[model samples]
Target: MLIGEVARRSGVSARMLRHYDTLGLVRPTGRTVGGYREYSPEDIRRIFHVEGLRSLGLSLSQIGRALDEAGFTPSTLVGDLIRKTEERLNREQELLERLRTVDAAEPSGWQDVLRIVELLHGLGSQSAARRLQAVLAPAEGVSVPAEMLAEAVLTESDPNVAGALRWALARAGGDGVASVASGMASEDVDVRRRVVLALAELPGDEATVVLTDALGDPDTTTRRHAALALGARGVTQAVPELVGTVLTGPNDVEAAELLGTLAQDAKWADRIMSALVYGLTAHAADSAVRMRLTQALAEMPGTTALDTLRQLSRDDDRAVALIASALVEKLEKRLDDELGQP
Candidate 1:
């Protein structure tokens, strides 16, 4: 077949076929009397082969090596293509996420779009300071959408930057609650923990509801944080976890203090006291735990807690006895003072 016939039948353009010939990718196998290029059957087959390889993202040089080099294997080149394709796909995905975030911001104009983009870039920067600045920079005039801040709060690992992001999310109010709440379903313990912390800072029934649900999280840290946040919100449902926190610790003091505050409510007072007393009884064999529980009892109000304190004041452990006795004295003195005793 002549070049024209080859181009017609194979759909390879004449110019590209000539270029392929010049590059020795698919040279014509013969020539006619007029000296025009003529392609044999094998040559046309090679042309198809080159086009086939190009479809797989092979560069011209790589294709040349693939076609001509006897030692060249498709395995290594195909592996490289897979990696590069994955990288391109990841880049596209990130771009799409960024676009969606920007669109969610509902920017008013090109300037707003640019500012949000800049803020996103800064948040993803390698430098922690830049991330911190990106979170705080919006206060100058730009209004960062709550969803964006919630996303940052979920992924941030730096303590200072994470704190700022939480503050910013909180200041943004209930708008970011859904975004932060989504992180609660993550299988990662740290992610769930971070979500709880972020939700704790956020104010609204939405955040409170999510924190209440998080009370059942399998991770202890996540459960504790959620319980504390719910306790502060006066949810009363946090009593179990807060009491458990008192029995076994990480933030036992804080938990105890919140339990004390919760006990101030008349309806929850006995329930909270009962849970604390149970902890004291259940953990009687563990002196340290008993001691912590004893101290936590000091936070409760009403005669029940005072009675519990009076009973613990003569306990088996000398340390528990001493601490409970001291707390008993303080509680009596405070009670006396309330009653206007001399």
Candidate 2:
């Protein structure tokens, strides 16, 4: 077949077939009477092979080496091509995400676009100070999208940077709660914890709802943050988790404090107190657990905490009895002082 016929039949352009011939990738096996290049059946087969390699993202030079070099192997070269294609795909995806965030910002002009782009870069900066600056200042000329801030806060690892991002999210306060809410279902424990922390800083029923939903997170830290936040919001649903944290977590002090605050609610007072009492009773068979539970019970309010303390004061464990007696005396005095306040 002549070069033009090859181009017409195989969909290879005539110019490209000539280039292929020049590269010796598919030299024509014959010449026409007019000296036009003519492709043999084998040459056409090589052309199809070149087109196939090109479809696999092989460069023309790479394809030439693949076709010409005795040692060249498609497995190695195809693996390399796959890796390069994946890298390109990742870069393109990153670019697409950046563009989407920028569009979400609804930039008014090129200046705003550039400003938002810089802020986005800073949010992901390796320098903690730069990330902090991004959250604190955001941009003077451009508005940082709330969802963008939510994204930054949810993944930000630095304490200072995370705090600033949360504050920024609150300050930018649109429907960013929904943005943070998405992270609640993340399989990453750190992300769920961070999302709950960010949601805690936000106001509105949406943040409360996000924190409430995060109560069931498998991550203990995520549950702790969510429970404390929800407890502060008077979401009585967090009482059990908060009580659990008080009995065991490193943040038991804070958990106890929040539980105390929750117990002040008339609606949840008895239920919260009962949860503490049950936790104490469940640990009655164990001294150390009982001690922690007793300390936790000290955080409860009303006569239920007082009555539980009284019951614990007569316990068999001397140390628990001692601690419980001391707490009971202290609480009784405080209650007396309050009643006498009139």
- Name the best candidate (by TM-score): 2
Mark the regions of model 2 whose C-alpha exceeds 4 Å error after superposition.
Answer: 69-71, 265-267, 285-288, 314-323, 333-342
Candidate 2 yields a Cα-based lDDT of: 0.84
Estimate, for each residue in 1-342, the C-alpha lDDT of model 2 and write its tens digit. 888889998999999998887877889999989998988999989999999989988889998998889987778877887898899999999899899898998887899998988898888888999988887777788777898888787788889888888887888867799998888778888888888888888889878877887888778888888888887787889888988886777777788888788778778878877777788767668787777778878877755588888988998999999999999998887888979962
Per-candidate TM equals 0.85, 0.89
Cα error of candidate 1 at position 51, Å: 2.7
**CA lDDT, candidate 1, residue 247:** 89
Task: Kindly provide the TM-score of model 1 when superposed on the true structure, using C-alpha atoms.
Answer: 0.85
lDDT of 1 by residue, 118-164 (tens): 88889999999999998887634467788889888889999999999
Clashing pairs in 1: none
